[model samples]
Target: AQTVTQSQPEMSVQEAETVTLSCTYDTSENNYYLFWYKQPPSRQMILVIRQEAYKQQNATENRFSVNFQKAAKSFSLKISDSQLGDTAMYFCSEAGYRNSGNTPLVFGKGTRLSVIA
Candidate 1:
C-alpha cells in the first residue's frame, strides 16, 4: 500500500518571506516520481516541482523547489519570495510505474497556504 501524507493542514507566511511545506509517503516501489501541485481558488492544479526517485539532485523551478529525501521517503516543497499569488492548496502526489500506463497518482490531503501582507 502506498500513501501520501501532508501533516500540515494549513500554513501562513508574510509576503516576500519563504515557507516550506512538508510531505511524506510510504511506498515499497523503488521507481516512482514525487510531485507538488498548487490549486488556486479557480481549482486548476499547477505543477510546482517534481523529483524523480532516481535523481539525487533536487528539482527546482523558479521560486519553487523540492527537498527529496528518498531514503526517508519524504518530499517537501519550498516556496521562496512568497507572494499573494502563491496562496493556494498544495498537494503532494506519487506516480508509480510509468510504463504500466495504469498507475494512478496517489495524492495527499493537501495543505492550504495563505500569504499575509
Candidate 2:
C-alpha cells in the first residue's frame, strides 16, 4: 500500500510571491507517476503537475513546478508569482499499478492555500 502525506494543513502567500507546498509518499513500486491536483471553490479537480518516477528532471508548467526526490520519496509543488486564482486546496497523488482504469489514485489530505495581496 502507498500513502501520500502533506504536513501543511494550510498556507498563505502574498500575490506575486512564490510558495512551495511539501509532499511525501511511501511506495516500493519502481514505476509510477506522481501528481499535484488543485481543487478550487468550484469543487473541480485540476491537474497541476506530474512527475514520472523514471524521470530525473522535475516537472514544470508555466508558474507551476515540482521537486521530485526519488530517493527521499518526496514530491513538492512550487508556484511562482502566486495569484488569487492560485488559491485552492492542493492534493498530492500517486498512480497505483493497474492499467485497467479500475485502480484509484492515492491522495493526501490536501493543503489549503490562500493567496492574498
Candidate 3:
C-alpha cells in the first residue's frame, strides 16, 4: 500500500518569490510514480511534474522543479518566481503499477498555496 503526506496544510508566498512544498510517501512497491498536481479555482487538476522511482535525477518543468530524494521517500515541489496565478491547491500523489493495470493515485490532503502580491 502507498500513501502520500503533505505536512503543510496551507502556505503563503509573495509574488516573484520562491516556495517549496514538502511531500513524503510510504510504499512497499519498488516501482512507482510520484506526482505533483495543481488545482486552480477552475477545478482542474494540472500535472505540475512527475518523478519515476527508479530515476536518480529530479524532474523539472519550467519554474516547477522537484527535489526527489529516493532513499528518503521524499518528493518536494519548488515553485520559483511564484506568480499570483500560481495560487492554488497542490496535491502530491503516488501510483504503483499493477498486474491488471495502473493503480489509482493515492493523493495527499492538498496544501493550499497563496501567492500574494
Best by TM-score: 3
TM-score of 1: 0.96
Local accuracy of candidate 2 as per-residue lDDT tens digits, 1-117:
889999999999999999999999997565789999999999999999988889999999999999999889999999999999999999999985555553478999999999998
Q: Mind giving the per-residue lDDT tens digits that candidate 3 earns over 1-117?
A: 788999999999999999999999999876899999999999999999999989899999999999999889899999999999999999999998868788889999999999999
User: Which structure is stronger by TM-score: 1 or 2?
Assistant: 1
Best by lDDT: 3
- Candidate 3: C-alpha lDDT: 0.95
How many residue pairs collide in each prediction? 0, 0, 0
Q: Is candidate 2 or candidate 3 better by TM-score?
A: 3
State the displacement of the C-alpha of residue 96, model 2, in Å, after optimal TM-score superposition. Answer: 2.9
Sort by TM-score, top down from the best? 3, 1, 2
After superposition, candidate 2 runs with Cα above 4 Å error? 98-102
Residue 100 in candidate 3, Cα distance off native in Å:
3.0
Better of 1 and 3 by TM-score: 3
Worst 10 residues of 2 by lDDT: 95-104
Clash list (residue pairs), candidate 3: none
What's each prediction's TM-score? 0.96, 0.94, 0.96
